[model samples]
Structure formats: structure tokens, C-alpha cells
Target chain A: MSNYLSLENVGITFKTQNGPFRALDDVSIKIEKGEYVTMIGHSGCGKSTVLNIVAGLLTATEGVVLLENKEVNAPGPDRAVVFQNHSLLPWLTVYENVRLGVDKVFAKTKSKAERDEWTKHNLKLVHMEHAMDKRPGEISGGMKQRVGIARALAMEPKVLLMDEPFGALDALTRAHLQDSVMEIQAELGNTVIMITHDVDEAVLLSDRIVMLTNGPSATIGEILTVDLPRPRNRLALAEDPHYHHLRGQVLEFLYHRQLRPAA
Target chain B: MKSNIVRLTPQQESPPEESTAVIPESASNAASTATRATKSVEKIPASTTRNYALWRASGTTLIKNIFLPVLTFLVVGVIWSYIHSHIAPEIPSIADTWTRAKEILADPLAQNGPNDMGIGWQVLYSLGRVLGGFALAAIVGIPVGFVMGMSENFQKAVQPLIQILRPVSPLAWLPIGLLLFKAVNPSAIFVIFITSIWPMIMNTAAGVKAIPKDYMNVAAVLRLGKLEITRKILLPATLPHVITGMRLSLSIAWMVIVAAEMLTGGIGIGFYVWDEWNNLNVPSIIVAIFIIGIVGIILESVMTLVHRHFDYSR
Candidate 1:
């Protein structure tokens, strides 16, 4: 399969009061079309920096990001991002939040009825159609994240970039929404790159899991392909014979091979 | 509550498992228990009706939230009436003030000439000046605040100048304003502008600076245009602070307009009060004072309501 997205030797250095601090060092990755990839790392390991670079939020100090064989220079409607806090504008109702993407990119091309229909379809896909009239503040965190998901999905983006979308959720809620995300991804078959800290979550939802080292400057430590059967259940995945093996290997790579002492 | 629910059923009822096993031994007791259970279930709907009614109740729920200020006003009025009747018997009573208020309302400028300053005319004049000065401040302050907020170098360079201007009182500027404007009203308005704009600009700059990195990241990722981002993201994010700055600006503007009028000599409520005091009409001065207070309260409430419109994240 042809790679739909490519990050070539991407590096980021932030200018601080003291001096320039390198956040990411010559990191590179290629993601295939319809790939569901999870980027796993410790905090400040530049996982989010990488995601932002790919999303065109930040220009890399070196190298380039390619989307569909074109250089990615800025954020566009074609690539949507779901933030960690589920940054649904609190002033807007669920319908309005999802319709924001539609309004931004598709308002000129589609009728109001068409837009409404599309919004409902995405909301229903995330099981939040009942909440379409409610503001983000009125909903629970899980529901807000689901609305964030629905908003991203409604864009019909070429790539969906998520920065720990479920990080703030309760364990049970996170798992439930993780499965919901997987189900939607399966239905839509869009490319997704999610930044996360949870190892089991990365394994359960990803086609491949890429782990990053600790940072003053960090790079991808290892990329592991998840060979688990499709339609995976989290409970069963934990009990699966291969689960322990993969988990052990990843933990070793994260805590042993790329370990850094406390600062 | 769970155990209470489980234990509350009549003991004579046949065990649920045994009955479901297709062999019931106590048919008569079971029937009575079922009837009793039906009665309890019927009561559940009545309780739910009470709950539904409770759910429908709307608006303020506490004295502090709703009626405390009104009660305090009543208490203060009672004390004022008592003092007027006994301690200062010659002082005008609330009744006399009410009559004066009505007369003032009937023909605000009647006591004076065609251009004589009526209470209503004085209030309108003061309000106009306050609004004019506050509007000018908002126009100049908000944009400067946004620029100072977004640029670190600009913030560092300009911050000291802002600090120097902040401590200079509006009253202190009155003479300079009069010299600059060469007109009493414009001079007074200028004082209002100076006093009001500083806090507004500073607060707005602080609010803009406090916008989270995550929000900027989202803006960048979405590739939102600078204009679009300002309107859609930055403006909304800083709304609470902007509204707060506006509140501070308006109140300061109101106060400065009165002070400026006292210094510059004008046809505003402030000048009216000073004029009445000079004539030794303490009662009219008192009335003017109360009117000023009432107007300030009204203006503040209006600003608060407007603030509520933008405070959705709460």
C-alpha cells in the first residue's frame, strides 16, 4: 500500500529565555493510507510536537511533512485534529460544534439540509445524536470527547490527528470511547494518527504502535505492528496469548532501553 | 437504600426462584403480596410527579442570589426615615423627597430657564459623557491590548509606559485636560477617557496573554487565518476578561466624569450637585447623590447582563 503521509527527518527547537531547546530530534515516520497509528511516549517527549508538525500547526526546524505527495505547510480542512481537552467551543451546542467543520469547509458546496443530514449521521455514529442540542458544558467529559470525535469525523478528513483525545476520561469511559473510535474508523476507513501515553490503549486501537524515547530531544524508539485479530475486544485482548508478549517487549523498550534518570 | 429496597417486600410472598421453577406452594399469600406490591408501585408514580415538579422549578434559589440586596435597601430606608423624623426633624422626610422626585420628573428643567439644568437633563448629560469617553477607551484600548498580548517584544517595551500612566489619577489630569481641550465638557470627558482606558487595556492584554498554548496549537493546526482566528478563537477566549475590563472601564468612566465636571464647571450631574451645594440646598444635593448612586447601579447591572452573554465556558 502507498504511504499517504510521510514525515521526513522532522526536528523542532523552541527558543527560550536561556537558549534554544530541542524538543524533537530528526524524527521520521511514514503512515500508509487507511492506517490507524498510535504514537506512545512519555510527556514532553515531543509526541504532541510531532502530531502538531504533521497537522501543520508548527513548522519543523528541519525536513518536511508530505500529505498525498504535497508538502504540508499549514492546517487545512482536509486534516482535522481532536484535542486532548475535547476543545469543543463551550458557547456552541453539539450540532453547532460538529457543523463548525461543515461551515468552515463545506458550507458553500452543500445545502443546509445536506449539512444537517451529514451532521446527524456523524453524531449518530458516535452515539451522541441525542445530545446535539446540548452545549459542551452540559455534557459529561466522555460525551464531549465523543462530540469532538464526531466533529473530526464530520470533516471527512484525509487524515484525523488526535492529541490524547481520551486522556482526560475515566478508565471505563476511555475504553468505551476507544472501542467507539475503532468502530467508526473501521466504518470510515480514514487515516488516523493518535498521540497517547496508555500502552494498552495504543495496542488495542492501533494498526501499528510507535514508541518514543524520553526527551530533551527525543525520537521514535521502536515501531511495532499489532497483529491482533480484527474486531478486537479490550477484555479479550488482555487475555490473548500474544498480548503479554507484546506488552513485555514494549515496556522493556520504554523503561529499559530508552530510560532516563530523573532530572 | 439498596438493602432497604430488598428487605421491604412482604415476607409472605413466595420465593421468586421457587415460583419461577414452575411450582408455587403459597398461592393465596402470593396474591395478597402482589396486590400490596401493586399498591406501592402506584405510589411510585405520585412521588415521581412531585420529583418532576421539583425539576421544573427555575431561577434563583437563595436570598443572597435574589432578594438580599432588596431587603438591605428596605432596611436602610427604614433607618433613614427614622433618623429624618427624630434626630434631624428639620431634614426632609422620604415623603418630601418622593414629592420632590415627582416634581423633578414632571418638568426636569421647569425651575430653571429654557436652558436651566433639570435633574433629568443633568443625568442624560453625564451619561452621554460617560458613554462617549468609555467608547473612545474601548476603541483605542482593545486593539493595543491585543497587539501587546501577541507580541512579547512589544509587551516588554510598552509595559513600563503603561505602568507609569496607570498611577496618574483622572483628577490629576483635569487641569491638563482643560488646557488641551479648551472646553469644560471635552476636558471632563478627556479625564474620563484617561482614567478608564488604562485598566481596560492592561486587563485585555493580560487576558490575551493568558490564552492556553493548546488553543493556539488548535488554531495553527486548523490553519485558521489570522483574522478568522482572532474573531473565532482569540476573541472568544479572552471574552470574560474583556467584559471584566469593560466593567472596570465603565465604572471608572462614570466616576471620572463626575469628578471632571466638578473641576471643569459643566452642565452635568456633578456640576449640578456642586451648584446645589453652593446654594446651600443640601436636600437637593442629597437627592442628586442618591440619583447618581441609582444610575451607577443600573449601569453596572446592564454590564453584568452583557457579561453573562459571553461567560458560557463557566
Candidate 2:
């Protein structure tokens, strides 16, 4: 498989008042083109730090992130991030918020009309075309996340970095978003790196799930390759024995092997 | 997910009760709760009833708002009259103050001397000076505040200097203004300008600091240039605070102009008050007080309206 995006021993250390704090260490992963990958671990496991490193929002102290044979040193439109809070400029309308990124990313590449159409098309993908004129604050949390997804997708990033994209959402909204994401993945074949805490979400969306050990310095504990077939249905998976086995392995790793120690 | 729960009803009823156990994801469970929420919402009072409820609440609030203030004013008037009759025989009664106010208001454009402009002209002069000073403060202070917010080192290095200057009375700046400008009108304007600038600078900086790191992260991920970030993100995000700062600065501007005008001795409300006191016309002074108060309230109301217009989240 082509190593379309690679994290070669990527790590980061943040300076706290106490001292230098090691957040991630010796972490590495290679992602193929059009692959959907998820990083799952308990809270404070530095999962988001890793995603930030790849998105070029944080500079890795130890390793380098390579995308399409180029160094990733700074954030660019090629690595679009869908922030957890939906970071829609609250001042801009939904159409304008998405259009802002589309305009910036396609400044020279597309006409104004083309950019507007592209923004609308991406919003439609997330079923948010109806609320295009509304502001982020006017929408429900689910709807805002949809717009956030649209904004990220409109940029046509090489790898979509979603930091706990659906983590704040209710389970139903999450499941709904997950299913739509799977459908969109099949249609667009865009490489995506999502950080999620939900077990079913990790299993349901990822082609590979990277589980990290609990942190002071978190590293990849295990990488589980999901063998579930395409067009995977959540309800159908509930009864599938192979699905149960895959779920059980993840549960064992998370619950038994890497269960969070008490304070 | 709703259908999932409804379809499991047969099993739930059969006492095997292992039906809910079959569910693996909380996704379906949340669906039931959401459906129940929608069901409860459907059971709410109709639109007209809700509207009536809303109207009733607003009506009572409006009455309370109007009633309490009127009651307080009446009490104040009664106390003023009592003080005039019994406690302080020298001071004018509330009725006398009102009559004097009516007379002064009746002929507000008259000017008897350099220090004795009519109340209308006095207010207009003060307002013009306040606005001029406040505008200058906003123009100079807002950009400085933005820069302070962008750099913590600058904030740290400069904040101590601001703290030292902020609390010095408006009068302390009066001498400096007079010394620098060598004229009365500009001196008064300078005093107002210097005194009112601190709030705008501080508030604008606070607004900038209050902006969520997520927004900056969004800007970065988009590879937005500095200009794009400022125009698209920083300006809009900081505007409400800027307005709040301006609101505060305007009031300070208004407040200091009275003192500034008093010292500068020009054709303004402050000078009119001082002139009336010199002439032993306490009633006209009382009228000036009321005019100053009403103008302050009107200015504050305008600022509040503007703040509300810009601070829209939804």
C-alpha cells in the first residue's frame, strides 16, 4: 500500500510551569491514500496532539510529517482541520463561513461563481444546504458540526484532520454523522484522520484504528486493522459475529490492558 | 434508531428482557430519548397560548420597569421639597427647580455673556467637545489595544505604565493639556481625550485576549494571511468589545468634559453651572444638573443600542 501520509517518530513536548512536559513520544504511522484512520485512547492520551502535528498546527519535536513526499512544517489548505467546536466564524453566515475557506483556498484556481457553487455543494453533502443563510450560533450543535465538516471538505484537503469532530455530539447525531461520513468517504475517497473516544465510532468509520497508551508520554499502543466490508451498517454490525470479535478485541485492549489508573 | 427501539418492543414485552442488552451503541438509546423529547414538545400548549404567555410576562415586566422608576422619582421629589421646607431653607424646592428648568428650557438659545450661553448651546458645546475627544481616543487607542493583545510581552511591558496613568485624576492631565496645546478649547478636548482613552485601550485589549484560540487555529489551518485574519476574524470578534470600550470611553468623555470645561471656563454646561453659582442662581444650576443627567442617559442609551446591534451571536 502507498504511504500517502507518514508520521515518522512524530512527537511533541509542551512547556508547562512545572517543567517540560512530554506529550507524545516516538509515535509513527503511515496512512494510504483514500484511507480512513482514527486515533482512540482515554482522555489526555495526547491523541489530539498527534493529529495537530500532522495538520501542521504543532511542530513535532522529534519526528517529521510527510504528505505526498513533501515536509509538513506549517498549516496549509492541503490539511484542512474540522475543529471540535465547529469554529465557524460566528459573525459570518453559514454560506459565508464555508465560502471564506473556499475563497481563500481557491483564490486563483476558481471563479467567484465556481467557489460559491463549491461551498453550496459541500454543505449539501452534509445535509446543511437549508441553513446556509443562518449563523453558527443559530444552528443546533449537530448542524454546526455539519457546517464545520462542509467547511473542511470544501477546501479539498489531501488529508482531513478532525480533532474529536463528533465527540461533543449526542450519540444519535454522532451515528447519523458517522453513516454520512462513511457514505461521503466512499464517494470522495478522501484520506481522513479523526480523533474519537467512542468505541463504535472508531470501529464503524476507520479502516485502521490507532490506540494510544495512557499518557505522561503517550505512544501508539496498538493499531487494529478493521476488516469490516464497505457500506457497513451499524444495526447490521450489532449481530455480525466477526464484528463482535473485532469489537471484543478493542474492548479488551482498552478496558483490560490499558484501563486508566485511578487518581 | 427510534425504529430500532420500537421494533424491539415485542422482545421487551416477552419478559426475555434481553432486548435492550442486544443494543451495542448508545446511539439508539439517545434516539428514544430524543423521540420522547419531541413527543413532550408536541404536547406543549399551542402557539397562541405560548404567545399569550409570552405577552403576559413582557407586560408585567414593562409595567414594573416603568412603575418603579416613577415611584422613585416621586419619592425623590417629596424628599427634596421636605428638605427645602424643613431641613435646608436655603435650597430651592423640587417645584421651584422644575419651574426654573421650564423657563431655561423655554429660551435655550439665548446668550447673555461669554460665560452665560443658554442651556441648549452649553449642552451642544459640551457634546461636540466630548464627541471630538472620544473619536480621537478611539482612533488612536483601538489599534494600540489590538497590538497589545497580539503580543503578551508588549502588554506586560506597557500595562504598568497604563496602570500608573489611568488613575491620575482628569485634572492632573489638564495642566499637561494646557501646557502642550497652549489654548483653552484644545486643552479641554485634550483632557477629555487623555482621560477617556484608558477604558478603550483596556477593553479592546481584553476583547482581543478573550477571543478563542480555536479561531486563530481555524485561521492558521486555512492559511489565512495576517490581513485576512484581522479583517475576517479579529475585527469582527473584537468589535463588540470595541463598542463596549467605546461605550465606556464615551461616558468617561462626557464625565470629564464638565470638569475640563469648568477649568477651561468656556461656553459649556459646566461653565454655565459655575456662572450660575457665581450669580447665586441655585435654581438655574439645578436646571443645568437635570440637563446634564438627561444628556448622559441619552448618550448611554445610544451606546447600549449600538452595542446590542453589533453583539449578535444568533
Candidate 3:
């Protein structure tokens, strides 16, 4: 039986000049509606490849991906992404950057005023209402990422794909973003698939943390469930043993089992 | 009650990031006290004077910016006078050239006949042709550049053709343009078109290539239509580069128009310069040279402003 979003035996083999290099193999995940999942691994472990396949930005050579019980073939607005570097268009103001997606995706459903309201609403959701007129270049990195999240959220996609959304942000900024994301996710109940290297981030944000082994042919090594109760306050969770246990399991999987030498 | 200690945001706290303007307000406060304490420094007066003092601290700006350039111009005049006195009788002296330039300026819009039109008319005619050719080149080349950038196979297929055609001289294209259009004006315009299009295409394509993959990925996720992508993403992203291409193309077109009009034998600065040579009017030819340089500077400055407006990379 298929889940809300399912990747069954998904794999990719790139045709490089050297030869065919297998990046991922036999990777499968079944995501339910409103489930927040984080994929964690070393940099080259096909974590992004897996995310890409689900988002239909990359086609899996081996198997199928079903989103809302339909075959996922090419990229669509249904799988809106928050890119690592906060890919807000530098040329457009923060409002227009989000509105660029909002205008296109909601072209059919939303009226002009409704669309405008929706754009402002989404920008407000990310605490970026004051900077609506500023270009992406004018904003801070954390702020840009907030707008990136706002842009993706405005689409109201079936699945929100974040490829290391907080990777480029500072520790404090990352915590703020993580908290905001948690707050947003709790309110909206949006299905999220975030790829991250931070074990604590994965545990804090995800209902389940899917760990992957190192590549040549990377696949899911283990899936660790974080059974912590929410609204999971980071300060409160710092003292919670269950949060520590869940974090430890993910850490054990990464450093102990899936260890690769520093290149 | 207001707080005694002020908190600085990270932006303000970072000394390296602080703009020079910030230093002035703080310095002015200290400068006011210093001015009050000492009557000797009172002659300088306000912030403008303080800025001048700061300018002195930097040193050599006045000499480098103003004095040196004036000195250079005087040196050039001296050299021109020496050359006029000794070597080339064909070359007019600076004063004679200036007088001829004044005569040309006196009746700039005179329309006596086709060949006996004023210097302004010739310049205008040349400008019209350059603009036409430059506009056509932009309309054609910018889209071609976009196509080349968007498609790898197209870029590869067309790269060799562009390389081969780009280096073919403006004079060489003039003959081809004459044969094709079989008209003098169009032929000159065509030479400008051929000379200018390469930089536009190359620069625009480079701009398209320089865009980060993340942007296209955002487009992909949005499922932006081809037209929407162009309007919302591609066009704006490549605009600064397009302006740069236009700037380069305009300058080249300005340079080539003189040669182009000379070859085609038409109404332009190029033709004027050539006709003045035929008449042995060396002073007028010197004036034409100055006109060419002036027009080029104006076109270049306008385009540079446009480039700065669109340049998001900075």
C-alpha cells in the first residue's frame, strides 16, 4: 500500500565520464500526511539525491514515487522547496520573491487581491513583514532563509522540501529559524522532508530521523523515531532524557556505524 | 526614563562593516569641542571644512583629480603646437582646430544640401544609424544569447559559428551589407550591427551561464512557464549583463560607424571626416575627431549609468 508520499526502491546511477556511478540504491520511504521527516547523513551519502527524487527534480532510474497517490514525474508546485542558500531572487524585493511563487501557483485559485493578501500573509507568517520592500541582497542571511521558507509555505505544497535550510545560518539564527519552523509546522501540520547533517536539528524538528550510510551506493541505514512530546521546547528538551536518547541513537548511527574518514 | 548605555546591532557593532559616513557624525561632535577649545582652527568653520581637512589627510586627491588632468591637457596642447610648427603641415594647430570647431558650432543645424549639412546633422545621422543597428542587434542578439545560455546543445552547435563570424572585420561586413541591402545607409547600419552583436551575444550568454543553479531550481519548483521564467527570473537576472553588453556594443558601434560611413560614403561623422580629408580641410577633420571622441564618451557614460542601475551582483 502506498503512503501519502512514497518512494519505492528508488535509486539513481549517474553516467559519469569514468563510468556509471551509483549514487543511491534501493532507497525507500513512506511518508504520511503531516509527517515531519528529516534525512541525515554525511555530505556525499545521496541524502539530497533521495530528496530530489521525491520532489521530482531528479527521476529515479529504478522505481516509482507516488505523491497523493499520483505518479511523480517532473517538478511541480506541489513539491515546493526551500533551498540551502535561500534562493530568493536577488533582483526582486522580498515581497516579490515570495509573490513570484505565489502568483504562479495560485494563478487559478486566488484572485488578484486574494493573491496579494496571501503573499503579505505568508511574509507576515515568517516575521518578514517589515522587510517586504527590501531586496534579497539587502536582507540578512537568516532573514533571507526566513523569506525562503515563507516562499515555500505560500505555495501550500503537498510536501515542503528543505535541503539544509539552516545549514548556512549561524548557531543562534539557526535556533531561531528551527523554532519558527517548529511553530509553523505545529500550526499548519505540513508534510516536511528536510535534509540535514545536524543530529540535534533532525531530532528537534522531525517525527522520525532517517539516517543513510556513506555512498558509492548509499541506502537508508536506519530510521530512528523521536518520541518526544511537543510543543518540544529546545530549553526543556535539553533536560529531557528521551530527547538525549533519540539524539544519541542518531549520533551512534552517524559517527559509530556510518563513519567515513575526513577528506 | 531613557537608558544610559546604548545597544548596538551586529551591523553597527562590526567596525569593518561601518560605512565612512558613520565616522563623520561622531567626529563632528569631537570636532565641535576641538573648535570651541581652539580659536586657531576656527577659520575652517563647518563639516565641509572638516571634510576638506579629512581630504587633506588622504592627500593628493586635488593634485591627482584636478591639477594633474589640467596639466596633461596643457602638455597635449604644447605637443600639438610643436607638431604644427615643425613636422606635419597637413595637421592643423590646436588654436586653428578650435576656431574651426567654433565655426562648425556657430551653424550646427544648417541644411544647405545633402553634403553641405551642418556638423550636428552629420552627427545626428551617424547617431540614428548607430542606434538603429544597436537596437536591432540587441533585439536579435539578447534572445539568441538567452537561447545559447538556456540550451547546452544549442550553445555548443552555435559557438563555433559565432567564433568564426565575430572576427570578420566591419569593412568586410560592409561589402556584404551593401550587397544584401543595396543601400548606403543600411549598409553602414549593417556594419554597426555586425560589429556590435558579438559582444552583446557573448556577454549576455556569459551572464546567463553565471547565474547560480539555485535560481533555476527555484524556477523549477515554482513550475514557472517559459514566459514567466523569462519575465520573473531570466530577464531580470541577465539585465545587468545585457546593459554591459549594450555598453560594449554601443562603444564599438560608435567606433565602427565612422569607418562604416566613410566606406559607404554617406551622411555621418565618418563621411564628414573623409569629405574634409578630400577637401584638404585638416582643421575640420581635427574637429570631427574631437566630435567622435565626445559622442563616444556621452554614449559610454549613459550606458554605464544604465549598467549601474541593473547591476545586482554588487
Which candidate gets the maximum TM-score versus the true structure? 2
True interface contacts retained by model 1: 0.56
Tell me the tens digit of each residue's lDDT in model 2 across A1-263.
Answer: 67799999988899999999999999988999999999999899999999988988899999999999899999988999999989888888999999999999999999999998999999999999999999887778889999999999999999999999998899889889988899899999999999988888889899999999989899999999999998999999999998888888888888989899982
Residue-wise C-alpha lDDT for candidate 2, range B212-251, written one tens digit per residue: 9999999999888899889989999999999999999888
Better of 1 and 2 by DockQ: 2
Q: Which docking category, incorrect, acceptable, medium or high, applies to candidate 1?
A: acceptable
**What's chain A's TM-score in each predicted model?**
0.97, 0.98, 0.98
- Runs of candidate 3 with Cα error greater than 4 angstroms are B1-63
Clashes of each: 0, 0, 0
**Which residue pairs in model 2 clash with each other?**
none
lDDT tens per residue, model 1, B44-136: 776565334333321122223236556877998898899998798756778787776776677775546534767888888899988888889
Q: Rank the candidates by TM-score, best first.
A: 2, 3, 1
TM-scores of all predicted structures: 0.80, 0.90, 0.87
Q: With candidate 3 superimposed using the best TM-score fit, by how many Å does residue B88's alpha carbon deviate from the native?
A: 3.8
Task: Assess each prediction's global lDDT (C-alpha) against the native.
Answer: 0.81, 0.86, 0.86
Off by over 4 Å in 2: B1-52, B111-116
lDDT for each residue of candidate 3 in B212-276, tens digit (9 for 90 to 100): 88888888888878887888888888888888899998998999899888888878899999999
- What is candidate 2's CA lDDT for residue B191? 82
Q: In angstroms, how far off is B236's CA in candidate 1?
A: 3.2
